[model samples]
Target: MSRKATITQKEIVNAAFKITKKEGFEQITSRKLAAAAGCSTQPIFRIYENMDGLKKDVYDKAAAYYEDYYNDFNKTHEVPFVDLGLAYIGFAQKYPHLFRLLFISGQGTGGRSMYDLVNGSTENVVKEINKATASGAGNAQQLFMQMWIFIHGAGCMAVTGDYDLDEASSVAMLESAYKAFCLG
Candidate 1:
């Protein structure tokens, strides 16, 4: 009688994500992942051509989850900018390690796609600013850049415990900064 294996591709990916989250991405290895998944490296190699492929799959999965979080907030709120800022903080607080990997640690190829997601969200804010200001002299691109910098800086600080504020206070400060950016 032939016995079927219990390990699967999804299980492998899930194990990889858990390992990376707990032990940082730099430490991830196919053998480590295989062991974590309770399988041999052959399964991983059969599912993914190489380490890069596995990493890409992991990054894409994380990105999808991250995007879903942001998209859920977007669907519930009318103001995309404020919601995006809150989402930023929420993501950082909820998944501190993943947040660091996505934005802080300079790892993987997903950074460009992550930037595009933020840029797309910021463009909506720029549109709002344009509508509010009614001034052709102001540059939306520049405004978006400034706002992104501020939001990212705040998010990094909050995630890294550089700031002393509690969750409520940190979110409030971020909202205030966003509103101030809109006004200026």
Candidate 2:
């Protein structure tokens, strides 16, 4: 009888993500990822056309996790845009390597857009902005793009060891920016 397959594509992708989170995205490889998943490279190749496919899957999973994280916060409490900015910083601080992989640096050969990393999160933030603002003159998408650029810039600076603003200071800065853009 044929031996039962003991590995799965999701397991491989999850292992790859864990590897990336622990040892930076630059160090992740098919062989290392396969080892972490406790499977041979053949199973990885069977599920994914190549490493690029695996990378894309990893990115997708990360994005989903990020979205869920933000959504969970929303469900628990009503946080402002500035609070979301603080959460962004917290995430980066907590997972410096993974944060770099998802935002600061681009990985894989799939030509995936950086915007994909924040797709769902950004959408939810925009919806909150819309609800917070009653005028509704400008489009939420445009406002979200502007706020996202600001947040990403600040977050990247923090992750790259460039900015040293503390949590309170960061929240203040984000609040100021949100007022200027989303509220004003």
Candidate 3:
């Protein structure tokens, strides 16, 4: 009779997530995951068809975690979009490895265009933009795209450790960009 598996898929994923949290997605190898999971690599191969499948699971976990982080920030702020932008940068500052894994390195995005990315992900934020500025959907989308470019840049900067922008400065910069986009 075949022996029962010792390590579960969830447990392996949790170990992979921990490795990703500390070392970024690129560092997730079978050997490293085995070390993290405190088991032989055989269980990982048994659970996942290949490393790509495991990476996808890890990416999904990171994405969900980021969404929760954004949602938590939105709950406390007056302007959700502005606060979301701040939260995006703050997330990068706080979790640079995850930020690089999710955004900078293009682990999950694949070949999707920026247009598709914003349309698919920011429907609620666009609605909030319309409510806040009374702009039409087209204008709101435009503003969001513009702001997203700036916010993405700030996030990248935060992860790179090149810029040391404090919260106050970040808010001022976000406000300036928001007003500029709103006015134009």
Model 1 stretches astray by more than 4 angstroms: 1-6, 74-80, 108-111, 119-138, 182-184
Task: After the best TM-score superposition of candidate 3, give how far the Cα of residue 82 lies from its true spot, in angstroms.
Answer: 1.1
* True-structure RMSD for candidate 2: 3.6
Deviation from native of the Cα of residue 19 in model 3, angstroms: 0.5
Q: Given candidate 2, what's the lDDT at residue 58? A: 74
Best-fitting candidate, scored by TM-score: 3
Which 10-residue window in model 1 sums to the lowest lDDT?
74-83
Q: Model 2 TM-score?
A: 0.76
| Model 1 accuracy (lDDT, Cα) | 0.68
* RMSD to the hidden true structure, all candidates: 4.1, 3.6, 2.9
What ranges in model 3 sit over 4 Å off?
A: 74-80, 109-123, 135-138
Candidate 2, lDDT over the whole model: 0.70
- Indicate which candidate wins on lDDT: 3
Stretches > 4 Å off in candidate 2 = 74-80, 106-122, 135-143, 181-184
Error of 3 at 39 (Å): 1.2
In the range 1-184, model 3's lDDT, one tens digit per residue, is: 9998889988999999999898887788999999889999899998999988888888777877876776566434454267767878898999999888777776664554433333336554655576566533347767777888888899888998976988788788887887787778
lDDT digits (tens) for residues 1-184 of candidate 2: 9887899877998898888777876688778878899988888888888767777787777766666766665332233456566667767766777777777666623554655455463575655566545445366566666778888888787777777888768877876776677654
